[model samples]
Target: MGSTHAPVDLSSEYAADFRAHQRTLRLGAMTVWPSTVQPLLSRRTAKLVRCSDPGTYNLTLVLEGTARASWDDREAEYRPYDLHSQNSWQPCTVQVGQNDQIVRCVGVEIPRNLVALPRNSADRAIGRPLSAREGVGALLAGFLTRLIADTSAYRATDGPRLGAVLGDLVSALFAHTLDSGRELSPEAHRRTLTLSVRSFIGRNLHDPDLTPSTVAAAHNVSTSYLYRLFQDENVTIGALIRRERLERARRDLADPAQHGVPVHEIAARWGFTHHSAFTRAFRAAHGTSPSDYRQARHQPTSIPERASGGTPTGSADQVM
Candidate 1:
């Protein structure tokens, strides 16, 4: 991730955050980088990288602002926390808004063979903006954010095994994002089932009746299959539902436009019908009541880093 200085007209902070995600890799070559730049229309650069190493699937999480990605028949706009995939072997371009604005993104380059997904499925996912807030996308995004934020925690001894697990998850996420009904080998079916469940749950989060039974019934899977699918998640469907709701609520509460909206109303909007219950849950998850969290966010400066909706400090990766 090379650093390019911005035009003199723009704020110099443009390139400052560019350096955050470019930290050196301690985990083999899984370098994490947080970057804010325009589509690098540089064939020579892409070619040089291709010559040096195996082609990769570049996965990105837009940490702040928005960016547009285009490749083949697939072209899409991605926003903050949205995940998207691109193949390093092909020519692609991604650009952000003008007016000196910068779009922050966190990216990781996965060697193509390490992804474990079929070529067709990965192609379908390319340039598609996957929902990072839910499903396999959620699980993968969260893990990536943690890993990038704390790369030092990972020892060289953990490399091969963790890399395999990472590949498996990335495969599931790509398959889930595309939802392309390509027949898979027997080995893929088990991972496919869990991905389907998570996607179904994410789509139906607004339905207060989105219980495990309803989820299983909708997917034509028995409750037992649903249970087996999520065993690796270490969280129940109910817990996931609540966590997703609270995350959405946290983003809304931090938004200035939503300041006029009542805290209880915001909770109900995300499927929490009971005010007291929502408050309790919010406090339990955030270590403070929803009202207080919102109040703190609006107090002018010194807003909590999470409330800012920007890339976290000391982010380890950036996308070109």
Candidate 2:
């Protein structure tokens, strides 16, 4: 590629048979690319930077294989699940893949100004491999993987919102990596914390013990602060937990493979240990009892379909 903003020289021992694949998603100002490439070496020279520098930063999360990157006299090797950053203005070299193995990675590109961190701190992070296996890095890595796996969950209008979320996660991860968490803007901190809390909730939805107090304690936040976070989103923490649980149970009820699974079992699977309580909650949300909802979905095709189509009748309120 020869564009000044994104120029690089590529070489490879398998040049004649080199292959690469990438699926890119552009959300507002940020772009994500999940890619797989054969063993190769790429270099960005000073002359290329002088031609034009877009003042962008690239964050790459290695999903497979081994690679090395160097910039500003610093060099580091990255293995699977590790992350590294690159500055567009810096001259750099990246050697990716090894022993005929293909390198798989997810790359995120955003304008430098979008990252809420000191320029020097951000620069210092370049070429240093960051661990994506835990902490904020783990959250960012999981978000990136899920975003790529199902971009369809979001609508076109969600581009800017999704981009902003990505930026917040990146900034939080970088700040944590630099031990500058206190430097994050108040808004960014709140957003990142909220995201972390939500992720924790999703992972523990099957635990009936999951609650606002437990969630707050798990994240080292006060219950009041956690309530404030959900208040900002116009939802109660308790309600969000119940909603997620009900949704999971509803999904299981509607799945044909789960037909043999009893309604009470489905309810228990999603944290609803009380059959009566589960029935009332499911009815309130879906407008049908669990047993009825399951039967309706499993009805013969010859049955006259309601306006809700395959969805159970009275559950038209459900989001498509």
What's every prediction's RMSD, in angstroms? 9.5, 5.2
lDDT (10s digit) by residue, model 2, range 1-320: 67535888889999998899887677778888889999999899898888878899999999999999887778889999899788888899999988899999999999989988887887767766589998889899999998877664465667778889899999898888788988888888999998898888888999989989999999888999889888868999999999999999988988899999988888888898899999999999988899988888888663355674352322111111
Which window of 10 residues has the lowest lDDT sum in candidate 1? Answer: 2-11
Global Cα lDDT for candidate 1: 0.66
Error of 2 at 79 (Å): 2.3
Q: Give, for candidate 2, the lowest lDDT window spanning 10 residues.
A: 311-320
Residue-by-residue lDDT tens digits, candidate 1, 1-320: 23321111122334544322244343344444556564322222444444543467778888777766666566788787788677666655665544555556777667766566677667777766688887677777766676656654454566544555456667777766777434344455566566566667666666778888988897777878777777877988778888988898899999999999998888888888889998999999999999899998899664645455554333222211
Per-residue lDDT value at 300 in model 1: 69
Q: What are the TM-scores, per candidate, against the unseen true structure?
A: 0.53, 0.89
lDDT, residue 40, candidate 2: 94
Report the Cα lDDT for residue 306, model 2: 62
TM for candidate 2 is 0.89
> Model 1: what TM-score?
0.53
